[model samples]
Target: MSQELHPNGALNQANELSSMHGAELTERYNKSLLGVFGTPSRVLVRGAGCHVWDADGNRYLDLLGGIAVNTLGHANPLLTSVITSQLATLGHVSNFFSTPTQIALAEKLLEISAAPAGSKVFFTNSGTEANEAALKLTRRNVGTEQTPRTKVIALEHSFHGRTLGALSLTYKHKYREPFAPLPDNVSWIPAGDIQALREAVDETVAAVFIEPIQGEAGVRELETEYLRAAREITQAAGALLVFDEVQTGMGRTGQFFASAPVLPDVMTLAKGLGGGFPIGAMIVFGEENTSWLTPGDHGTTFGGNPVACAAGLAVIHTIENEKLLEHVRETGDWLRAALAELDGISAVRGRGLLTAFELQTAVAPKFVSAALDAGFIVNATDEHTIRLAPPLIITREQLETFLAAVPQLLTAAV
Candidate 1:
């Protein structure tokens, strides 16, 4: 016996649940919702292409692209079509059964992985799980299921995610400080410091995790030379190099997985992997390392949701069929140029679709809000850094429109 709530009251109920609509609704949300994010921005009602409309129908350019997850933009027809067709065919079947979409996605991921000796993928629902699974597999590689090795070296300002294992690896103190007794033995190394990494990785360390672009710390691209150096260091020491491609993968960094100078032994991917749907994977290289986690070591239920896999398949196919990497390379060069030309923007960082600018002043929040007022969506991470990770499908005209608004918003603050 169950009762259905009408959409009329449902809207109000939703507002009461966690939305910051009006003073009354805001108060209700404050009382119940976790205070982590503090307050909600306007409720986004609909989205299309690179634009999103709030509940009040105010449209915005959506340059952040849902924190880089919406690589194909909001409500992409391809994502919608694949998800619909897959749902109609078969949606969810537990690990007891197999679906074509699930197996196909795994195979496609491996095809893209195409490293020496071939790789295998493990599915998860989010980047955090992908990282957690990767970390667990790393533990196994260190040998001894009993006292398993504990040390992991992560980069400073790197953001893996908020889960216990991933949080342990995240470099930011604020995200990890509150939870003091984390799953231990994690050390923070400077992003591009090869010697420091050399010191950090001894025989005791199980894995070394890094993000090619440290997205949360205002987009720091690890030098390819340093990456190659890390490879030599890790290989010599026998510690695995695990790349957390949660932000820069899936054609975002123009290389189609931040295809670095040195291939990592393990790569974790999410964000744009499913093109908007939630899907994450941990790819282990070759036979020797790919079998790190036997069955019963790690798993997820809704990770390979048929619809998500189909959406991922569509996303990968679209990236290849539509030839988006070329667009990203050319458009990214132009966007970086246009952004760097803006007065008072001190420096531009990142490559491909993932790019950012450092402000000469300390009013980045104001700049972000001003951009919103100008009908553009951009974010300022610290007092001096503005991040821009837009859709891979954004056109030259669309990028020009965004570029046209930068100088005004940036210089307007002062």
Candidate 2:
């Protein structure tokens, strides 16, 4: 028989954890909830500023940041305050009319993206909806003639979203095959290959969607010149260049927009835009392009809710006021270097806070399991890839502690 010990030196038999908060809750979840996610990793109870506590009262340094959604960390006071205040004033207004906060957030996005005057915005509740809206816009841009130019070009190993239209653009066969007969006229090309992009994008293509930094593909970042090439090719083909910055936007890539150098005709944003709140926006540049979608072309009931917009405003304010961009650049560089020095890590990829490390062996899941036991949170995006998208507000000391324990954790995992 084995035993577990409490921090206060009390011995507990292994079977005694049946009454623990996490165990009990997990059991309840397994019985009641759908098994879409397989099993709950942890029954987290509360969180604060880059850390969370599980139901069992075990604390963990949250390096995953809700899969890069919790931009300012959990329960940020400024973000919470704005959301509460906005909700108190005006919770939501249908697409019939817009609120001040909603309009302001749109203006902020335009400013951040350096979108030209007359650019337009459409909000959604999540990244998938945003991509869905973009997909519709692309289809509509060329009109629905007998042979409409509705073809879309995307990169392989990329993830756009799960919605039928968005999933059609997502390159994973496993995710796509199960839900076959998706919207047709979509093609995949190798990422980071300008020639592939040039060969794929032609007059028949309606749009070319690329992630400034491919987040779900283990933080694979495409080169600036490649993006420039995409822009030129898309423009020549009269096709819209759509940049999916759902994970790379809002200063996660050390810049306001990871594709700022090569501006796209359409940009889809979500994830960190509202810190932790659910909001997504698709900004289309060029007045002619914006004019393609007239009234009734697209709409969302709760896309730009005042409360969500307020949360987004607060997140942007905090980032600018606190100068977190500079911190992300410095800290990300430091963290990359530190992780590279680890014995088991073969390479590090990505920019700013969105990072992924390649392991020496295919033990990423084992490493993630060990990291959980070691009081840290990480994600195994693939068998050999560990993605780390910590809160931009994470302190140097917090990351240093994680760094110090990396070698030991890797050894134990291997």
* Clash numbers, per candidate: 0, 0
| Candidate 1: C-alpha lDDT | 0.84
RMSD of 2: 6.8
TM-score leader: 2
Give lDDT per model, in order.
0.84, 0.89
Q: Judge candidate 1 at residue 56 and give its lDDT.
A: 52
Encode model 1's per-residue lDDT on 282-345: one tens digit a residue: 8888787887888787777888888889999999998999999898998899889888888888
Q: Write one digit per residue (lDDT tens) for candidate 2, span 138-238.
A: 88767346646868899998899999999999999999999999999899999999988988877778999999788878899999999999999999988
Q: How accurate locally is residue 49 in candidate 2, as Cα lDDT from 0 to 100?
A: 98
Query: lDDT (0-100) at residue 335 of candidate 1?
Result: 88
